[model samples]
Target: MSKFKKDGKKNTPAVSTASLPDIVFMLLFFFMVTTVMREVDLKIKLSQPDATEIEKLEDRSLVDYVYIGEPTNTALYGTLPKIQLDDAFATVEDIQDYVIEKRADRPEAVHGAIIVSLKVDEETKMGIVTDVKQELREVQALKISYSTREKVNKKKF
Candidate 1:
């Protein structure tokens, strides 16, 4: 027997993918944990005004939203500004009922901490905002927030 053929076991070349499934599972779990689904679908168009002072909301669960703007489908709601609670257009008189319903959803322990965000369009007059504010006050929903775009500061090089 030749020297090369003395021990005739050939070395097999193969790539090990044993860790691939673990990597894929880790990535899937990462995305699943980080992703947040959109809670509300906005039917109306909102152009929020820019503001110098802005504060980020820490807990999203305790906040409620009220949309104020001219309806996207202007033929239906006309050109006038209207308030939207959840999915439906609401009048100033409807605010009390809506506040009551939202307040009821929260636990009594944190009733004072519930925040109502007023998302109003930039072009919308303050009259509509004032009306909503007044209505909110009537229901004693004192914690209110004005949603606005953060003012960008340009650094002079």
Candidate 2:
């Protein structure tokens, strides 16, 4: 005689996944909101100079960026300080047209409020920068700022 009887039917457990979709969607939204998508892909390496005093831009929307550095893409561009406007490598002559197009993208009221920030490598010569400045001046886009890292002070014990 058997002490226990065998069950005719096995119980099928149901896993609850009703909230899985919500959790996945929440994670997706979180990443979407927190992530910052870079507008330009830099082909150069830039080491920003250190500064004793640095001022932060008040409004980011009213600012445009220009990058100058030695090209990291050695095969395409040689190892010299080159200008980058948005995603492409550009020349001094492109500055005026670039500024005009960028300025035109903004509202008319904010045209005067736009600031052009230059992120130039410390090793770069001033000649290229001077040319960029002249181009900006020609376009009447005189508001300019040099991007630099804040100096870190170390005290002797």
Candidate 3:
């Protein structure tokens, strides 16, 4: 006689749930470390000009942005467009200091590679842009870029 009988059905083990929380937490931590957030809360109303030729910067870490536009609160900041450096409203004379401080934050070797991008509103005066350029010259930060929108159809990306 046979010692044991063979059964047609076999039981399958349940799927493990222990590692599920670990994966969820790991994904949360990964996004927290790798994601980049908006640098500043823009107080100005900006409408960038259109451009046919535009080139995207390769490394965002090497570029700093300067924003110029009319204030969202016209009653407080008035109708004239204002210059924004970092989080605060600044004058044309403040560009040198701002550039110097920004350069100091980066590695010495990359200081020369840093580019200052001007995000100017279309309705803004040209004089302010000229002054900002002069200030950059004083700091020896010659690399510059003008931020503009691409001339594309609404449906076309």
**RMSD to truth, every model:** 5.8, 5.0, 7.6
- lDDT (Cα, tens digit) per residue for candidate 2, span 29-75: 99999996785898779899998778999998999999999999877
Whichever of 1 and 2 has more lDDT, that candidate is 2
Model 3 misplaced stretches (Cα beyond 4 Å): 1-36, 153-157
lDDT of 1 by residue, 29-143 (tens): 9999999876567767899998878898888888889999988998887889988898788899999999999889888998889899999999999998899999999999898
Ten-residue stretch with the least lDDT total in model 1: 4-13
Off by over 4 Å in 2: 1-36, 155-157
TM-score, model 3 to reference: 0.74
lDDT (Cα) of model 1: 0.88
TM-score to native of every candidate shown: 0.76, 0.75, 0.74
Best by TM-score: 1
Candidate 1 ranges beyond 4 A from true positions: 1-35, 155-157
Which model, 1 or 2, shows the larger TM-score?
A: 1
List lDDT for all candidates, in order. 0.88, 0.91, 0.91
